[model samples]
Target: MSENNCIQYINCHCYMTIQSLQIKARMFSRISLISLIMIPVIWSQDWQVQYSSMMKCALKGSNTHLSGSYKHPNHLTMIKTFWIVNPVKGEETINLVDHPDYKGRVQYSQNKDGIFFLSLSNVTHKDEGMYCLRIVAKEDKYLFFPGIDLKVTELRVEIPEEAVEGKSSILFCKTTCHLSDKTNFTWFKNSKRLSESNVSDQLLLPSVSTDDTGNYSCAVTDHKHLSSPAVTLSVRYPPKSVSVSISPSEIVEGDSVTLICSSDSNPPALNFSWFKENQSSAVGCGQSFIISSFNSSHSGRYYCEAQNKYGSQRSASVSLTSAGDQKAVLYAAAAIGAMLICICIFIVVKKNIRKTGDAGGQSGVSKQEENNSTAVTDQTSAKPPKPADLNESVYASITHSRPREQQRDGDEDEVQYATVQHHRNTRNTTAEDGCQNGNSVSAGSNTEKADDSNVIYSSIKSS
Candidate 1:
């Protein structure tokens, strides 16, 4: 061979070696990647099987199961031959074949892929124990899985023995199972859900009252399990909405009255008292106060108080009045009216008497004038009588009894005269005066006309 041909052969040989190295390297990389992926999968399956051996908690009177498995793809031919159950305390070991008594309660199944499961129906506290599984292969070899512990749990609620009305209270929800942080709690009152959202395990009440008294229960949202039974909360409180009720609302004096004190309380009211307006002390003590004969003394604003061991409350005040007082006021008003009427009558009578006296005086004066006009008087008239001596004077008796004649005289001017009797001096026709002559005389005089005058006199001498 020539030098170039030898060089070409050497290049071809080197190219073939390089190509073979590349192919081998690529294959090795593919295999390494596949191996890396398989190692983790295998490791995860082993981890799951090992983790399944840990203790498990389940609620009593509920269905539960224990599961076991061998390495994933490699153990495809593996089969669960039997199941063993170990109880917590006694030497009672249970197997699938030997425990005929547990045939109905215990269930076992193994998948074609080597996944094994054991289920217990209506699990009770007595079923708490460790469970183990046995795997059998076609090689006549057996693989014993680690034991798994089974724990029975129960839900319970804890609350205070007693709660006070208008006071804060707390209730707690608990369970025997180990709960995760994501677990949510729910509360129910009288079998009614309080809220739709998840809440804390503890229930807090800012204030409680008689309305809050009911059956309360709690449950876990994740487990969909409730507490065994509901608990009843008792709220103790004082009297509330106190009031006083009176029978025969329309009251009258001298009538019997009944008063009742009413209040709402938890334990019931032990004492009741009645009070009147403006008084600080109670007037009576009892749930019912009776007034045998109500009178003005009982007419006033009244209220009642109800009390118990916890506290006391006062009722609204009510007013009462007697009818006798109204009647008395009316009678007094009538008496005052009568006295006023009498006073008015006296004033009217006094005014009338004064008017009558003035009229009578005027009438009496007119009557006296009329009597004088009808009267007639006669007396001896001596015209121009000189001074007469006592011996020469003569006295005569004169009388006129006809009043009609005196009035009939057309020229007569009626003159009224009183009768006079006198003795005059002899020188004087009139005899001067009776007293001067020292003689008693009677005389009368009347004038019929302006120029005519008639006078009459009568005289008597003293012995």
Candidate 2:
């Protein structure tokens, strides 16, 4: 037959087979019968089977069961069954009774309903294949079921022995089972999904770096089925992202400051060197540089270099200055000193002025008291003061002494009188002693009156 005619005949046959299977489907709800009828049409029409493959995922060294079915309606009993394996060598057929290749490791059985299955024990990489069942009816008719692709994937991640930064590296999602380019693959790094479902089995890192270094794994697109355990990927590179830090961001004079250096590298930064701006050589070494006492000498722009076996990197400059509080404190102290001095000067000046006023007031009071005493003395003595001392004016005068009055008798008609000086320094004046006949005669205490001018007329009696 011509190719076109053969194709047309195959199509016609497939249509008739589908119609027959559909008519019988109402009699039986079993899905195996319908699939068996359509398997031939599917195989002939499409070289690339569009139907999803029956996936049987098993771990290495585990037992698995692969199911296949071929059922027919009345007057059709299964006479013989065979299994076909598509392996690397080619397509192979194994009889259920005595298969030499899988002698004791495999068991095959068919139930009364015409469903067939096989159990593979201690499955290994070599046993992975596309399996199908071929059924022979008692009427000598034959049927083939669609394949149950047994994928005994020993899922694992393949990593390069050495990965360098800024270089390309590839990670492979390895499996012993045959996988096509259309198979969906999932990649994970550090348990995080790297990308959505992809068709490529290999994950490419255009430039492997520290960011790409992590635990990696792969899985089939179906989340229910996973491929491999995670493996680690390490990338080696020079020290990078160098940084410098101060323990206390604010620095102060007389305070100890700690300088820390850090960098990101695969082998880690093995050496650290500290440098100051405008300096020709490194000032310090190690991961940390300590200043026992910070000062202007320690204040400058500083940076650090981190080195490893690969290379070195320098950090950006960081500036350090004395804490502002120091200047503030100084200013405060100076101000306080000035204020204290001012206050002290004010108090001292006030005390001196008070002393001077007290002295002047006491001197004036002494002079006034002296004048008052002289005036009191002059007035009490009933004498005028000296012209140089004070001018005295008599408002009222007090008598120093008083004498008693007495009555004179006619027989003794002589009056006695005495003269006295008011002050011890004053001269006494004698009163004129005058006496007349028929008048009273004045008599002195010590001497008798003589005449009118020299002795007063005495009172003479008739006797």
Candidate 3:
């Protein structure tokens, strides 16, 4: 036949074979419209005779009833039969049992019922795939049944390695499906289930701490199925018991101050820094910090911070002012200035009194001297051309009482003359004419003489 006629013939044969198999399948089993079908129909005509053989078989579950069909126009005989499995698309291919004795052979059987027994132990996921029942006859073809789909359930959990103390933390356990649907969920801490509610997707520790640290796992089961790969939760925080204080609760200019930062932490702080308001400055990791000569520049809202492997924490800010020193200095200066002024005033008053006293004393001395000189002149004039003896007698008594009486006398001539006579007589008279003769002078004369001398001397001194 021509190529076209031959192609038409093969097509006709394949269509008739499929139609016959469908009719037979309908009569044998009650299948749904969506049920898959596999049929064997040969297209080549190489005229050969072979024995039928079973090459591979894949059965799902415990049911080993394998059902498929193949057709051949030529006579064939049954030979050795062996089981094998089809290769998967994305996984490694395993070599199933092969039957060399049944190679290039065909199979013929009177048993039309499609059922075969297979070992249940040999059934596995790797054995799952499209399986074929090969029949070597006048034409070689295969009866195929698509492999069954296998599903696996795995349990997975996610949680943070570290958590802040006293903070609510969540431990999540996720699965392919809801635990209530087909599986039971059991949360474990150190291998103890903590499932009390329907919430199996998460395990909650309202407040977490280092004491809560341990290996955590979820026991997820679907009937007899179980999963592995538990999770570990390491509850940790940056630190606790953070504290801060300011040295010299009172601050002043030109004074050294410090800020102390301390805390209880594991994996001690690595970065210690200071901040004023929002501005940050690098600092050493110490409990106390010293800032020499604190000033207004150092005055502001101050704070400290500590950091560790977990995280960082900041202390409350303390406000500082450096105006104290300025105020103190101003007060001291005012006090000193007042003291100095008082000292100066005292010194001035004392000096003025001494000068006044000295002037008064000098004036008095000069007045006395003048009075004595004036008295001498007067006495010399009054004595006249009398005898030196008489003059001496009068002057002698005058000189004796003049010193006592001169200060009381107010007359200038009498006092001056008497003073002169007194000096002359003291020089002229001898001590032998003492009391008796001196008393002979008049009391009025003596008194008047002394008063005049005092007045003249005082007047001259005053001028």
Q: What is the lDDT of every predicted structure here?
A: 0.69, 0.67, 0.54
What would the per-residue lDDT of candidate 3 be over residues 1-463, giving only the tens digit for each residue? 8999999989999999999999989866545322323223222232221212223332222112333333334454544332334544465333233334323322223355433322323233443444444343333333233332222234667886567777888877665423234435667677665655743666788898788888877655322123346677766678566667877887778889888888767667766777678665554446677888987777667777888888888787777777685577779999999999999999999999987986687578667766886788788778653444443323322322233234544644333232322322333443334344674333344332333332211211212
lDDT of 2 by residue, 1-48 (tens): 899999999999999999999989865754554543363333321211
**Model 3: per-residue Cα lDDT at residue 161:** 57
Give per-residue CA lDDT, model 1, range 224-253, as digits (tens): 564557988889999999988887777787
After aligning candidate 2 to the native by TM-score, how far in Å is the CA of 265 from where it should be?
A: 3.7
Clashing residue pairs in candidate 2 are 433-456, 434-456, 434-457, 435-456, 435-457, 436-457, 450-455, 451-455, 451-456
Is candidate 1 or 3 superior in lDDT?
1
lDDT of 3 at 399: 24
Task: Return model 3's CA RMSD, one decimal.
Answer: 28.5
Give the lDDT of residue 378 in candidate 3.
Answer: 82
TM-score of candidate 3 relative to the true fold? 0.31
Order of candidate numbers by TM-score, starting with the best: 1, 2, 3
Q: Which segments of candidate 3 are over 4 A away from where they belong?
A: 1-84, 87-144, 151-154, 160-170, 174-180, 196-201, 205-211, 222-227, 236-238, 243-463
